[model samples]
Target: MLPAIVLSVTIARPWREVYEAFWRPEAFPRWASGLSDMALRPDGDSWVGEGPDGAIRVFFTGHNDLGVMDHRVIPDGGAPVHVPLRIIANGEGAEVQLTLFRQPDMDDEMFARDRRWVRKDLATLKALAERG
Candidate 1:
């Protein structure tokens, strides 16, 4: 199994409200900087966008009652990376969590960098969600 880490941010909003506001594939680029340079456009069952390395295709989990917001990202000519994200109730607020998997080709440094990236993205999400 691959090494993994789960990072999270607490948002001052209802879990359902937060999920409803940003669970779609198009909303990802607003916080997930690593996924898109600008915006993502729908392409069949997935979305296409320009990533740092080039173009990427992303497949997002369908909307449901559960707070699941998982997605699979396929970089141009590269393997797919699965990102597991969720928003769960934390009292009257919500906790947004993301799991980062250390890929087979990743070194300690690479994994650490990705961890930082995720952390920053989560912070951005929190700010966006909490904004008035």
Candidate 2:
């Protein structure tokens, strides 16, 4: 099993509203900098976008009543990396959680950097959700 870390942020918004606000493929680039460098365009059942290393194809969970926002990212000529994300109720607000998995080839420093990137992105998402 790969090493993993779950990072989360609490946003001052309803869970369902928060899920609806950012569940679309086009909405990802607004905050998930670690995932896509720009807007993702629909391509068949997935979305394609320019990622940090190069091009990437992402498949997101279909819209549902549950707050599941899981996605799989496949870099150019690379294996798919599953990213599990969820938005659940936390009192009157929402708690967003994202799981970051440390790839088998990743070193400590690389994993740390990815962790920090996810934290920053989550913070950005929190700010956007609160203000929207």
**Error of model 2, residue 13, in angstroms:** 0.9
Q: Give TM-scores for every candidate, taking all chains together and pairing residue i with residue i.
A: 0.97, 0.98
Model 2 segments more than 4 A misplaced? none
**lDDT (Cα, tens digit) per residue for candidate 1, span 1-132:** 989999999999999999999998888999999999989999999999999889999999999898999999999999999999999999999999999999999999999999999999999999999992
**Models, CA RMSD each:** 0.7, 0.7
Error of 2 at 127 (Å): 0.6
- Model 1 misplaced stretches (Cα beyond 4 Å): none
Tell me the lDDT of candidate 1.
0.94
* Per-residue error (Å), model 2, residue 76: 0.1
